[model samples]
Target: MVFIQKGNNPLLAVKAFVQGIGLLGNPKLRKFVLIPVLINFLVYGVAFALGYLYLADIIDQFIPGWLQWLRWILWPLFFISFFIAGFFTFTVLANLIAAPFYGMLSAAALALLSGESATITEAPWPKVIKAELNRAAYLGSRAIPLVILSIIPGINVLAPVLWALFGAWGMALEYLAYPLENAGILFSEQRKLIGGVRWGALSFGGLAAAGLALPLINIIVAPAAVIAATIYVREIETDNAR
Candidate 1:
């Protein structure tokens, strides 16, 4: 991961995501990345099942009889809309499930950045889990309003954009937490670092935002996003150094 850009370039920020995918070539990174990927897979597998088996049926109930004439057009659009909306819903929920492990993953990703072997010292699970749960709760609470708006007919129209932007911002915050935390940077400082290169942050977020909307890709996106965000942070620091 060469420093792709010195300044906050939106396109470079977006490219950071691609760089993340490239980083998986490390092979060792794959071992650690799988933890989050599998966790997300199992949780989302059940979610996909439930959505396929029940959610659509429930949503179909909301379609009025008068709209039956437009079933072909409306149903596809609705399902597609729901699929995209599910990206945010599922990403938020999956992150909550995997939060306990993210710090470890983020730390590992950071280590990998240094060309160091990602030998993670086992953390105290109880304490770590508690902290993660609290963090997830905070993030969850922030996400709830957007999740609710996604279901309401009038407001759901805006749900995609709102949820995408919100989810991406959360991605920036969550993935960067471990590396930044390690550096003794607090949230205020984290915000400043990210805010300085706002477009870079959003571009990183945007790729993540788009990834969440994808199908199979969504499964692997979180860890990749974390790795990408780590690289992004390092690039910021490197750029500052120069």
Candidate 2:
């Protein structure tokens, strides 16, 4: 089973992502995102209709006859706005619903390594906040470098691999570190604690990201990825102890 595969293998990262979707295996989060997205769509639709009505007379008078050609632009922009609003609403709700499961799965992943998962129970909020902060810091630090790397001559050739590799590393660290730190382990200490297991976590995250990128199938990938990471981390800790 993919679940039992060595977590450190980068080649397996994509599979891990696909497999994570299976683990989440639930329709609940889907409904959660859908409901909010629907509401946003309706709200935006109403606002658009009302605004158009209120502005109908003023628009006809102010807008030049030839400027009416801008209807092409306005129509697309209007729909695009609705699409964005729906997507944003869905994304916010998805994150909130997925956070708890992500936390638990992250904890479980660490537990596989025989690292204590207690912080999930003992100090949930602080650990969650710390993970979020670290993630923000990690991404912020890499932003400029990533932008520069994208512009390089030959380096551009290696961009995809680098993207996959770095993406996996960041995600792994974010998902796995929370549970470890919550157990009273300091953030710096995690560098050493997760030393050999970093590749494994990266592999899992890479695969998870791949799954998230898939068409239609991506809806459940978020939570599934979290659970798989949790499992992978837990297994790594177990093997490390032996």
Candidate 3:
């Protein structure tokens, strides 16, 4: 394992993300990544099929016949809204379902990074599920206000900027939770640690979010993000220990 020296660089997150992409070819980590990829593929396949089949009907229901002309204007906006909502919703659902595997993946990645033998342990499923639910609730509480802001007349202009920032921050917290939780760090403590290096965390997650929004590429992003997050958390710990 090659370790990058710690520094006060703002681009550390970018480096970590690139390194993480490189690490995906590792035989040791491939199995851990496989399951999540398969899950994503299956979930997304069904979602796309369903959306294609009913999207027209769904739009028609929302827009009355008198307002049919508005479809041209609202169609693009509807697609954007659906894509954003579906991405976040399915990401959360997929992670929740695969939480245990992610926990193991995080542990293995940490071990590999530390140049120690990879020890795959059975995660405490109940605890893992509970932790995932907690994160969902945390994201939901904040997202509700953002959703409302996005609907307002004038103030809504700033909502996109706020949502982008929040999405990046949320992505950081979401992935970082895996490794930190495996190390027995509490959720609150994980936030504080990531908050200490907010810029790097956001950069890492922003890239992850971008990858996730792309078609086909998103299948690999989940596991890569997990590994990248493991790397990020390790760096954070090393820096703080100094």
Candidate 4:
């Protein structure tokens, strides 16, 4: 009975995310959710360990000797920037690896929400791979500029905030792509549809991004996000049909 009325309500995104988490306990979705959770657990564990070990060294290389005095201020900013960047970078990699499983999960979730049969055909892998590459390219085109900005002294102050916002948007688009793609929505059309409901997308993405940063909770966030995105997209399509 988890449902959302379609509109621009940003809060709808929050509700959808919660509903997704709730739905995880449903007997119907548990199987679909398991593999993605395992994938995320492995990816997240490695990313966290690597970040803990090498992130400071990476940050040091970015700051020049003359900027040593600014370490107190810059350290925090760079840490936030790197953390966000690294998180999303690894997230993209994880998603690429899990795309097929995610497609099946999306299909099942979509079927559940739409009250249709849960059985799904094997996802078209070629289309799924193409869609993932398109998303990676789209995110990279923007990420490069943000990475460049994060190293510049004066302007770098804004890098953390900017990176955070971009991360949220990218995540929203990333998760939404699965269900949309399953529905045979093209990448271009997906962007347009998400753009039409930007606020809700951002909020949902922001919450998901924030959740992923948490330790134990992050293991489940990916699959939940997939479900949430499915719910969000389903509601939007329903509204359009009205």
Q: Judged by lDDT, which candidate is best?
A: 4
Q: Could you give me the TM-score of model 1 versus the true structure?
A: 0.76
Candidates ranked by lDDT: 4, 3, 1, 2
Query: How much lDDT does each candidate structure score?
Result: 0.68, 0.49, 0.77, 0.86
Clashes of each: 0, 15, 0, 0
Error of 1 at 11 (Å): 2.1
lDDT of 1 by residue, 1-242 (tens): 12224536876666767888787656767777777889888877877787878867866876688877866655655665566556656766787667656666667778877878756765566755554455567667977786566555555667667766776676666666556655656555666666666667766777887776666787888888877777777777776667
The TM-score of predicted model 3 comes to: 0.85
lDDT of 2 by residue, 116-173 (tens): 4334332366555665555556555764575455434334444455656666665565
**What's the TM-score of every candidate structure?**
0.76, 0.54, 0.85, 0.94
- Per-residue lDDT for 27-87 in model 3, tens only? 8888888898899888777667777787666645645567668668655554554456557
Error of 1 at 182 (Å): 2.9
lDDT of 1: 0.68
What is the C-alpha local distance difference test score of candidate 4? 0.86
- Best TM-score among the predictions, by candidate number: 4
Runs in model 3 lying further than 4 Å from the true structure: 1-10, 54-75, 152-157
Off by over 4 Å in 1: 1-7, 63-85, 116-119, 124-135, 142-144, 147-155, 186-189
